[model samples]
Target: MGEGLDFAVKYPFSSAAKEILKSDGFSNITDEVVELAVNKIIDSLAGKSRKRIYISGAGEKEDLLAYVTARIILGYLRNRYITNKFAVNESKKVHSYLNEESGETVDRVAEELGIKTKVNDGMLLVPLPVFLKFTPRSPHYHLINRCITNGFVQIEKQEKKRMIEEAVRKHLERVPLVKKPPQKIISAAKKIINELPKQEIQATAELEDSHPPCIAELIDAVKKHQNLSHPARFCLAVYLIGIGLSDDKIIRFYSNLPDFSEKITRYQVEHARKRGYSVPSCSTIVSYGLCRANCGIRNPLNWHKGRRK
Candidate 1:
């Protein structure tokens, strides 16, 4: 199993690993087993294994196992670390905007921060987890950490506060160019300053009838004990909050889900409320196949304007 797993990691696109995994004894491989196998494979590839295991593609089962294992690991990695080109580029923009005074281009800053923003065609790839193999001890560790943690360079409260102070100090040291700093620097400073922690809002029960048709449909589905998809549930939660529904009321709405967990649901709803998350756009709703009514609008928030029934 160990040798086969190692082979899978080495030649992920091959079919040998799949054959081994699908064998009678191994056919019942659970997610836990696959995860363990993936970790082992990663360790072997990283040279962390006690003894190197040679993977020869000579045997049929060996080849099949290698392929299957590779696919599983790749899929897991893709889901965990892979993101679109737009997200990476957006992070680059944020990084560039924040460090403008440092006289460094976005690419240079990214390289200095050890952020790998590789774009091929329209796909953006960042080998985030692989960075763990090399010990990184740079002043930009926080920036790299953000790339890994948030999958983007979204300024968090603590970091934002630190950056704001640094910017202010820098400004104080320099002679005034005008009455204030350049608009670009001022905008960036304001952006960082606004990165405060989300505050909890008092939920109100008003705006039920004003809900967009899609949100109304989701609420009805939840009430009827129908299971909603993650995106659907998220949209509904955000819509509810946008329409002034309390966390408790949203919890009640989700109570009938087949897989409902009270603690988890409450936490998610409260988090959305506190963070002031808004409903997804009409296009997103349509992509989820949750948009039932035409509503003749681009935004879900506006769906209730003309039709309040």
Candidate 2:
């Protein structure tokens, strides 16, 4: 462990960190390196390590450390000693802004950072640590913090997944999309989306009336025997659970769908209920064309605020 830690500190911008930042697959990263990074981050997050390690060199070196640190933090391996002055200042600004508004969206913060606000693409473009490094302390710090915190794990996972997907996409670009059966492609896509990390839903019966238009649209679709998309179904299940719906009641919502499998639906609902998975975001719902209209809000969880009871 000591040897691995020394290797990581000396090669802080090691090949593994570079691959992760470049969205390259973790093919070249050794288990030792990952273990070291994880340990350091955990120590930092637990406040067990308050010793800051300063790396002085060209901007490239610092950038690499920032990238690795960001991944560690996203992986829930955070520690106070792993941060630099710039990161600390930016983090402070972010926490301050979040404290003030308590409702800022990641898209809004990404927009402020001059990042494109496309669903799942915005935050993944820049690693959180890199973003913090470049973004100066400003009045919008709180908003940025909220966005970062909200999707912290997703953003990191997205970056890695996007890299692999991009590679696959490039390799498959030559393959004709029309050649593949639409149902097969759809099934595969659905499986991937459903399997990705989900947010935690704070189930509340009061939020039912405020369900986002997309979610409401899904419920109507389910009732009408119109087959719901995988993401749509997952969102509905999560939303229902969050709103205090029981597993059996949620199973009934999916009973009429063409692809409905009583066993599968029940299992999924019970899993989500037990694990506390959150519903999809407004951007994600919009990406699927499930969004009914622009509600002037960033998160689907907050959609109820704009609706009239």
Candidate 3:
């Protein structure tokens, strides 16, 4: 493999990757590429995707094209859940790859993804504005918690890797939705979409209980960028813990709120779990003004267990 193809195969979202792919002029858009894209999505949700998550290891051309094809699939479907899952996983994959790379390579990838930074006294210094732009909803990363000087946030290698993942996610979220995607791309996307299980399996595969109506309503509010009341948020967090959701997954779900602070979210979820708290009873929820319906269940967990919806 040549230098460009090698880099593109490993980092498909990079400029080198785009340039090499453009040189092929769509010649790589074969049935195999489409099929690879479909299988990748299926595997991703199944919790058994390939290590790279974005790139295929078939060969030089297929490896580079698979990433683009997957993006096309996401664009064609226009599903937020699917897009978010794929982007988050792919970005973390980039972070994992960076873990083994030299500091110079990591810095180069950061630059390619548009995170401007400089090295200062053995630390990577990200500009305040640039850091603010890419920091996720996590309070742990906000400048208030970081070391700042000369209008820059000082970071070590590990923090830079994480910030790179957010940068990559931001890039992938803008899936290139063309007026007309290739027929093969659409067909593959539809086939994959059809194969999705009847009950929505979250990317983490742990929201098996999914949501009762009331919890779903709260989720809708969060997704709409509305801030939840403390009571509502506490109720939802405890309910999620009562189910099988890991603390990390619950934190990610809560990250959608308008004013998400990872520090507070982690504390609330962990504190609720440690105390063995249960979801409030239906009557208590009503008192909090969160009960969405008079469903006959006593609690959210009882929504489907010998009870009404």
Off by over 4 Å in 2: 1-210, 305-309
C-alpha TM-score for every candidate: 0.33, 0.32, 0.68
lDDT of 1 by residue, 112-164 (tens): 33444455444433454423322222234334345443343333333432333
Better of 1 and 2 by TM-score: 1
Give me candidate 1's TM-score against the actual structure: 0.33
Q: Give the lDDT of residue 190 in candidate 1.
A: 36
lDDT of each: 0.47, 0.46, 0.75
Model 2, 195-250: lDDT tens digits are 43331222234434546677777776665544455667888888887767788777
lDDT of 3 at 194: 85
lDDT of 2 at 238: 88
Give candidate 1 regions above 4 Å deviation. 1-210, 307-309
Which candidate, 1 or 3, would have the higher lDDT against the true structure? 3
The C-alpha stretches of model 3 lying farther than 4 A from their native spots are 52-58, 199-218, 221-271, 275-309
RMSD of 3: 8.9
